[model samples]
Target: MFGGTDDAVIGFSGTGGQSLRQQFVANYAAKTPYLGLLGLSRSPTTISLPDGYSRSFSSTLAGAWYQGAQGYPASLTFGGYDALRGNTDSVLTLPLGAEITRDIVVQITAIGISSVGDPATPVQNVAAFIDSVVPEMWLPQEVCKVFKDAFDLEWNDDLGLYLVSDSQHEELLSQNATVSLSLESQGSTVTIDLPYEAFYQPITYPLADILDGTVLHYFPLRIAANDTQYMLGSVFLQEAYLAVDYHRREFYLSQAQFPGNENEYRIVTVHPPGWSHGLSTGAIVGIAVGAFALVVIACGLLWWFKYRPRSKKRASRLSAKSTEQDRDVFGYYGREKDGGEETYEKRELDTAEPGMRGSIASRCELPSPPLPQYSPGSPERDWPKDRGSIDMVEMGDYLTARRVPVQSPVELSADSEHERRPPPVEIA
Candidate 1:
């Protein structure tokens, strides 16, 4: 069974006498927030075919979480990625971490906050893992303190969260700040900017043990005791696109784009390394040039056969008529008393149909509509207030029920001493 209602039975192989299906069937007792977890790892897996053979599942996986209230739906694609969801020009590919548990790790150089009329203020650097399963950013305590000051956040010791008060929420909305994270991997860097709306989250019962059963607004952040706990979670994925090629042991990160219209979405297949469409650049160009030449030749032949002969016949007829009228003209001129002095009448040429010119002129000279002005407190200015709630409940039950106990703060360390590897090849 998948996604609650969609069910299918297939041969799945795994170790420890437990197949993928068996694991999922056993997960009901765990009462996790997600109905199922789609495997995106590069490990070899196979699907049994009706023809008594099996085939490997795709090696590439790409996806972006739905930007709640922002009108972008979650998307997942196997073997390729949705090109329109990610900025292709800014893609940064890095080799997977040596440890399987920390596959998608990157060194976060800095986290900055930028508000209207204010310059960005960046905090210290840290190495963080990007994991969508987690619901909040687990940063060093000092970084969390910086965030608290920047956003006027208050820590709820009882709840273990940064809870926002009504006035503080309003202030943040009015300020309209953006959080930017500068990430580096394999010497390549990319900055992902998350608007205020991305962090405008709500906490509800079941997900958060709200005894009053009232929804609360909070920033998704946690203070990590050590480097192992540092994580950029699903909240960060709201504005970042991730593509992983398990086969090649590399992954890519790019700023996620949320187009206003569905028509703007596009998918681009991530072909395997050393793969080709069996055509070279020169071959493609040659084909295009040849096709254009053929079209031109066909047009020339069509004009010669269909219109040129008729044009010649019409010209001959006009010549004959002119020859026949020449004598009549001369005869008329000869009989004229004014020595055939020609008179010509000057008349203005109508460049357009009677009303077309007047309408076009009127339209061209008309004033443009005045731009709409909005006051600071107007509904238009307070757009985030009207944004839909981000369903924090979907983040998973483990967030509230199985959270790790807070440990004593440990001194933060420089991430530069970590091992570095060469950058991975670009995925097309």
Candidate 2:
């Protein structure tokens, strides 16, 4: 429970291994802490807890060590975890509300009947807390009275809530107005804007076996004592994110992101004493695979580009050599048949012109017959110099035969002398 209405102070003491127990719990997701303000000196009374090892408390948040007088501090020294809410964005900083101050105030800016937008009002400072246990806002009677006339709200004593008729609800939603809070600290003030839909609370009832479909649309604001300041409560926190640092004496608040919004999530881990930091197993594996894939792709591209030019140069050289050989042989080139036998193409030569015979025989390296000359006044044909013609001939039987060696007749000894001999012929 919050100490917004009256003065409340509690303390404990023990000695010789016997200690008093206290607890401090923090919910980072909800942005609230139980027993967070215990040691923070509140208004009308100062907050304290047991400090000795024998008389101490257990806590999830990091605790601070006090080095001063037994009860209160002459020169108070605090640490970061005294009211720590964990690390958050610095742009979310909000000014301190009137909690320990004498006046119970929850000042905020809202639209007036004669105003076009959020207008300045006399009630600009109100005491409020981002409470998790409560579901709605609880305001002082004076502030509620003003909202009643502005929103055209009807108070239902049976339901103990301010209800809006269907027509009024439509009119309020159509205005598209917002309630904003201004928190001041140092020399700057941060404003938090809450949309009108943040306060639409619907309630249902079940009568016997049947159900009454009466929907109670409300703004989630309750009337409290005049001295009691406003409570911002969970209704305000549902759409807001908050961070508090007691050691620095500062808090931060910003509008929360919706579920569908894209965001980068970075986990903030709190390390107790003796804990070390290192990379996780999954993260290490991901890095190794990514590096390997990049290396493989780069090597493949380099190899292909290096060999492409060399292949093209080799093909061009072979093509040029083939063209030269074809011209020297008079278009007669060997074409391999099956069983390794070579075949050649034959072309017939015509002897109608005088110069055609010499050109064809010279290019094919063959003997040429005599050509007839053209008579006077006859038309001469202009033949291209680069082209030549050759006559096909049967050369199988004209080819030279291979030579064979013969052995000479040998004379024997005395018995072989009887062999007859022929006389030599006289030269004429």
Candidate 3:
């Protein structure tokens, strides 16, 4: 009743990706050696006969009805309900052409019902036993499609062994126990999906995760559903890369999975001249360390200049005191003439020690004082002895070089970064 009536025309529509045969044949032809798919009957109407192999229901020929026409119904008008499977009568296969289109065509048949029951209106209900019968299921298609779509393999006539992707299977698909139609690229496989309840066969996912491969588009299925009676249902076939010798009617099958790139794997390569890779982390630390070293060196120089001068204080105390007195006595900082006639003249002080200058001036001066002259032998008559002062330049071998003038420590300036230098004193 869902498909309408058993005898009524049941129209179905669906879509799918490129047919496996077209894809397989195209790949094999790509090599320099030329080949393609073995063309079967372009369209199959009935499995009853191979185009012209039909004969009446011969006793020995009933096998051909199921095997030839029924089992191999690649193309037909409509499909029949497999009473056993309990699944809707929808069979699918690869469609012609490369561009993905849907609802191209499918197989269906005429069903029958009888309208022979009499209708009687009852005012009082009469006791009657009613027995309803459920349809029997011969559901081979359910078991066939559900398990067959997991993978595709082919025996290589040239290699004589089945080459399959064992690692990829054990990883993403097998562990998850999930299945979808996956198309292959060079080294990776991507899944295709669509919207709507009919397409929601296995599971559900967001629109973002489904836009991967050329396979499993919705347009073809939309086209497949345009029929009034016949509708090609969705098919489940992994990409099958096959090989065919076009000249020979018998085409060979191989794991076309390689071409579709279903179950693909990715391998990243990092090649030669990788020398700079290890240095990146060290380079960052090196910059930080270099900055710290500069700070330490600058701080050390500042400490030495500011504090080193304290060590030379004792040696030059008298010399420094004499210079200060000379400046004040003949200075202009606080002195001025009140009267119009000047009473004093200004003179410059020679930066020399009193010990040497006094000795030289006394040597040439006339001395007439003779009162109480003590004999040289008497210790009480001797003048107070003077020790000659040491010249700073000649005191020690270590101090021979001219020392850098001590500068004040560089603190954070008012502007944060600008360091100001103090003015040097005039030495004249």
Q: Among these predicted structures, which one has the highest TM-score?
A: 1
TM-scores for the candidates: 0.52, 0.38, 0.18
lDDT for predicted candidate 1 compared with the true structure:
0.67
Candidate 2 steric clashes: 10
Q: Would you list the C-alpha lDDT of every candidate in the order shown? A: 0.67, 0.49, 0.28
State the displacement of the C-alpha of residue 386, model 1, in Å, after optimal TM-score superposition. 99
Candidate 3: lDDT of 426?
26
The global Cα lDDT (0 to 1) of model 3 is 0.28
The positional error of residue 328 in candidate 1, measured at the CA in angstroms, is 67
TM-score of 2: 0.38
- Sort all candidates by lDDT, best to worst: 1, 2, 3
Off by over 4 Å in 3: 1-142, 145-281, 293-373, 376-428
Report the C-alpha lDDT of model 2 over 122-222, residue by residue, as the tens digit. 45445565554456777767777776777788998876788888888887778875666555445555555566666677665531122567776776888
Clashes of each: 0, 10, 35
Cα lDDT for residue 364, candidate 1: 23
